[model samples]
Target: MHKRTKSNIAVMLVLALCLSAILAGCGHEPDKPKPTKNVVLISVCSVRADHMSCYGYRRQTTPRLAEFARQCVVYDNAFTQWPKTTPAFCAIMSAKYAHNNGVLRATHGPRLADEHVTLAEVMADAGYQTAAFLSSPALAAHSNIAQGFQNVDEVFVGPRRAVLPTIRAIEWLRKRDPKKPFFIWAHYNNAHYPYRASGIPNPDMFVEDQFYDASRHVRALKDPRAHLKADVPRDHPCVMEILRPDIGAIHTWAVLDERPEELDFYIARYDAGIYSADASIGRLLDELRTLGLLDNTIVALVGDHGESLGDHNYYFEHGRFPYDATAHVPLMIRQPRGAGARHVSTQVAAFDLAPTLLEMTGLTPPEDWDARSLGRLDKDTPGDNLVFTEAGYQLDYMLAVHDSEWKLIDVPNALDRQMMRHQEYELYRWRDDPGETRELSAAHPDQVARLAAILDEWAAPWRAEVYANWTRNQTTIPTETSRQLESLGYVGSNSSEDEEGDDGGD
Candidate 1:
């Protein structure tokens, strides 16, 4: 009887252990690894936030971008540290001010120093497949603007639109390694100067008045009698005999004389360029969606810097002034799965982009970077942050200190001039006077003093460091690069003797 009981107990115990194992398998499964997210960064040159349809422009210049804005975390008051392409991009990629990053001027500074780790390097280190497709010749590999990117293509160099880059980016995406996450940067120069409005089949539809093509304007400037046809009425500004071949110079001369009516045509052309860029961006996004990667990829769109558009007597150019028209740019980030869509009015700088992107992608930004990540922005965030904008060689090292309500433009040109005894300051209540028509430096002495002190404290160290190593920081511009700059109407010297005629560094 004892033997029989022992056998029965053994059988029952075996069945209990099997049941426990089955229950454990059914109740809880092991944790699966999280999928890595991909990233795409899109940048357009010379785009003014106010002129974009998504940013409250009356014109529908960026219908596709406006649609994209709905899926993005749009930053309404974002600003760039520098107004020039190379320096601005340096600030964005290095998460450091231009002066600190060693690329303070376009076509002049040494390629971004290898010492500072770039966003591409970080992404690459984090196991990302990095690539950069840029449309600006100024950003060619020789300039080191594509630092740390494994694959780079600057085939469509010049002021071309986003078409070629978009196509190339799509092809790269299709052929990229499916197992590894990728980081792709596509920079478009469509909205930049000459404002040719090229990809649009019918630009006249976007213009309020007659469409004046860029070539027509250029021809008229070269030889008024032969090129300026009767269509260019006597009342039109282009009818005037301007010796300069660059449209920007002629536009500056005309607008300064209060002949701004013709500017409307140019503005319309600029809008059309934005429209072309928007369409190209739309196509790229559509491709992402088609490939089943839209939800998994983070899409970041921004303007490297804003165009002057005749503001502050700086026409059709940037990097010459630190006004809001040139400093304020469009910044939007489409989070993965279209999450976190909201407008952030808190002031932010281009440098913040690097760290923000790094944080969003689950990577850690370098501890020594001068930027703070904006990934945690919310509706109640304070707007008290001070954003700084620095001028390039064109402005003789000017700086603008901005707060939520006031902006102070400090031009220390006197330091370089033997005859001048005092610095120049221009203060404006930017909130109430966005146009900045009324100067307040003379009226608000206290504000100027306070802001000036802040500006000097913030800029002094960087300025000292930059000038201390000026010779080592300069680079020789290649002949082909000079030709590219000339084609884009961005060639000139940084000599005070030729300051009156110099127009290229920016």
Candidate 2:
């Protein structure tokens, strides 16, 4: 009987050890947030930071987002790695440069390669439900922009609206698995070109009604010969009665010379578009709050790129220029339970977004990412402050580097050099001349050489690899996507050495 009692006690001790081992295993993963915590990423296409109310614009273009910005960490000088939609997003999602990620243009471009792990994939692997609602064909599944998203809802149907995607996101959040956290991305194309802000209360606040009088204003293509002129008379009448969805890039610039006041109408329309998008975003935030997810959700807002409103004569376009008009964008992050709500004024790149999201969610970002998390900025970490921007849509390929006060745009393409009167480099003290009106490359030779060397050293390796495999990496756009891009004015003729052609805005 004593022997039997000894064996039972030994079994009890072994059982106790097994129980403790299980409990310790559970406690080891305490760093990861519970499944209740969620993440929401909101991206707006072609939103210029300078045009937003929160950014000090005269008009209240983003009333909803401006209020929302007060509760978030706003990056005032954020720039995109690439100004085009596909390349910009690829850089953001992969934490890599556009050249390295293999997505160079919005259409007829290389898709995001399968090897690059995206943010959605990371969150999904962490047992979070990952989804994306996109309005642009640039982010279509076939383009590989939907790489890591498990559920993707694409709206390619013409007349893109932010509300469509926002509604889809709200619906998905309502029906998501309650046991798992969610990582959702909602991209709005309402701020994109052919700005038609349907449902916006007052989109024409800054413009006179006479500008839209169809009886007086006519929509007609200017003589192809006048495309390059910096100024033309009112007789040219570059203003269009109804801005067609597929208007050419050069035509918009022609408006600057003729019917200049009419530009306000288009600008107002753009602002209205922004306001409409803000409302849709407000609705999404409301849904999150109603569902009791706001307390646990991390919300982030970013612009893929900005639109040029007559900046450097690239009116109402993007992707072709390396100017701040197209490169600077808005970035904001609202942490869970309103933690870390402050403004970060230093320079930040869109590629930094991946690591920022990862670190915020209790996951360690990979050390090799090209950009670092903005958290380092919040903590005043001493790190690289130089931000880079590249352009390869339709114009000559260019590379730009920006420090806190200086910006250098290096246009190395031979065609571009000849076209710009043999001027190959442009240096702007952006803080003083945000318009980039005064070219100072000749005056600031020292600054130009320093930034040019940095850009060349950093880009040489990737540029060589990209050029060598450019043809192989290029993907054929699906038929429907091609149609959508064509309608959106992205599928236009390329510029030639002899004559300035369409800007091929994306």
Candidate 3:
């Protein structure tokens, strides 16, 4: 009896132990995740390359960037998703085309769709500390651009708010436990509007903000209409009024066309603004180098969009179609010292920049995303990509896709007989006539047809995005949000775009 009892008790104890082990094993947390790799992306604005020496410009506007470019892969033909800041930045941050994102016009304050995925969120999921020092309202927190950033200092204006981003970024970098990973995007707005570095309180910001005076402002603002002599087609007389407002104060921003000397003066002012931004950036770069984080990180310098500066009958600001001066931007991808070939001429878009950076850091882009990594696409595996851009009214669609030599512009809803927005469509062979003055739609109908087909096919999916984002003020206090978006330079207030005729292309 004692032996039987002992055997039963031993069996019961063994069974209980097995059960406990199974339960405990099931409850045990998986291996602690791998430490995230750190990545820092620095996005600047409107620092035009033609105005800088890096892109073969006569001016010495970008001394700091030139040094960085030595090891970086510089893209000569990197274009923006949209010519305006908000839409363009939306494309860069969200990694989506502008039309699928939102209207990229001034006063356009539509919030990004909640469904849209951001690069920061992707990195954050991979166990990284996401942060952004956004110095521009063009990327306001009012939008979802700041969704994944744990410590985002978006108040990049005023003195108190000014030092915080740089100070905090350096502090975070210094204090960050090496065990954890990091992802930071330091967006600099020093080159944007209200052009005054004197108010910035940093002598290093600009060489001399006080060089130019009110007289320059007054003279440029006078008769702003007279400056629209950029070979605009005869029928497009109204373009002068539609693009640049008669508001006298706007011209002071950039005296592009008034006097040749003003061009020098205006460029000087812009150069000073660049210096201001460069100084701040140089500080951050120094911090990363000091921390020894520079080698492992891929620091990319790119403008969200570009400015016209009186090119092609355009003014200094952007909110138009992708003209050469406004759309073509400077892109420098400085990976580990010898990782990439020195420079590449692969044509890419702003929307693709984020994905490329993510890919370079060994992250996979979402399967449905439209952009591809430029690093992967080299001369050995060169890809001829057709980048699209939009601006102006929805009804005013401009579709441009080029193969190095030929660029075609389809301005649908042209008005006049000679392509002043009268006719339904207009096309131009850019290689034959780089200015795009000739209305060859009627002359060479086949080329126009082929381009139209290409655009229609590419826009089909983006059209679906249009219907999805279209709606009335779903958010309460819509006015303030709209105003914030307007301040960010997105065209139009928060309003549902309902018109069927409103095409998404520009």
Candidate 4:
């Protein structure tokens, strides 16, 4: 009996040893750590900072954004490198000025060169999955805007609304590798011109019967030149009809001309579109939370550019001028793990976004990048006060520089003779005269010269290389893309040069 017991014990000991060896092998294998963070960049096109309620606007156009801002670092004064879509996005992605990226124009010749490193490239190189869902045809894959994105979806069938894109983004997020980080860029194109008021709350708040007539008449005007190309003839039938007593009465009561009231109506429509966009964003945020990804994700909301809304006599759209109306955009950043909300009033450029995001993600930005991280902005960190802007489309070549209190705009000889007749230099104490109605150039000759010198020195290197590079690698957009751009007032001929009859601006 004792011998039998010893044999049984030996057999049991061998089985225990086998089990211990198996457990040790399993423990030796490395355990994969869960990805700590994800990034979602939401770019809202043509969204004016002033229109949002959080920016002191009376309208509740962005209740959702207002709530989101509570958990974000809200930037009250954020400016774009260029007001147009392509150039502005390039600046954000490349962390470079328009000159460095060599994308001066909205379309036609200047495309984002291959040499420059994009934000997508940087993230992808760092082992993050990069994807982009663009609503604007101006940012199509062929535009070289798809440089480092592993996946790009620009094929939303109808008017580029936020709903479809947001849905697609959520779906992509659900399928993304749980163990890997991701960088997703989604562009919302709702606040653009030809504003659709469908599904907007309180669409009739600013509605006037005559305003509708004026809007319809303005839309019916066949002459493309009358719309955004240039100032319409005061005596033209469209103008006369709009200014007629039946249509102009409500408009003329506030301002001497019909323009002020007409603009009021247009602004109402624009606000409605903004409201819709805000709702869509709220939906996206909610979905992220529902999917248990909100806390681990970094949410950034910004505008590519703002609409003019009749500022500087340039009505309806953006990209035409360098006024605060178009240049100043809203920027909001929500860090992972519920970082507390803070408002940053420092004047920062859109290019700073790339570096800021990189630093936030525990990555190092390239030293040569024009953008600097705003990581210490909450600590009252001091940075370069100067913000530069440029526009080189068909209207007029413009360069501008602005500090906290002053702004200087230099319009080189216009491509069109009519535009050339306008002033070549404009200086404004923007703090006092936010409208930029008063030109202080003559009054402040010394300041003008000083700013001009700065601009010239800054632009010299870019000017030397831009034209040559643009001519060397011009991209011809597809016919379908051209038609889409034309519908959005980016009309031009099909040639590699400037589109014919394309009085480029916003």
List the lowest-lDDT window of 10 residues for candidate 4.
245-254
lDDT of each: 0.72, 0.72, 0.60, 0.70
Model 3 per-residue lDDT tens digits across residues 305-419? 6665555444456565555566777788887763663776656676777788777767777765667677556543344567676654333445566545445555553431232
Model 2 misplaced stretches (Cα beyond 4 Å): 1-36, 158-160, 209-261, 378-383, 394-396, 418-421, 492-505
Could you give candidate 4's per-residue lDDT for residues 156-270 as a string of tens digits?
A: 3364344666877888888988888999988887776556543345645545534344543222222333322344455321232122111112211112122434545667667
User: In lDDT terms, how accurate is model 4?
Assistant: 0.70
Q: Model 3 segments beyond 4 Å from truth? A: 1-36, 159-165, 197-219, 222-261, 379-383, 415-447, 461-506
Best by TM-score: 2
Q: Candidate 2: minimum summed lDDT over ten consecutive residues — where?
A: 237-246
**CA lDDT for candidate 1:** 0.72
Ranking by TM-score: 2, 1, 4, 3
TM-score per model over all chains? 0.79, 0.82, 0.73, 0.79
Give the Å shift of residue 467 in candidate 3.
8.9
Across 308-354, the per-residue lDDT of candidate 2 in tens digits comes to 77666456767766888889999999887778778877878878988
Q: How displaced is residue 111 in candidate 3, in Å?
A: 1.3
Range of the 10 consecutive residues with the lowest summed lDDT in candidate 3: 497-506
Candidate 1 has what TM-score?
0.79
RMSD of 2: 8.4
- Per-candidate Cα RMSD to the true structure, in Å, reads 10.5, 8.4, 10.8, 10.1
What clash pairs does model 2 have? Answer: none
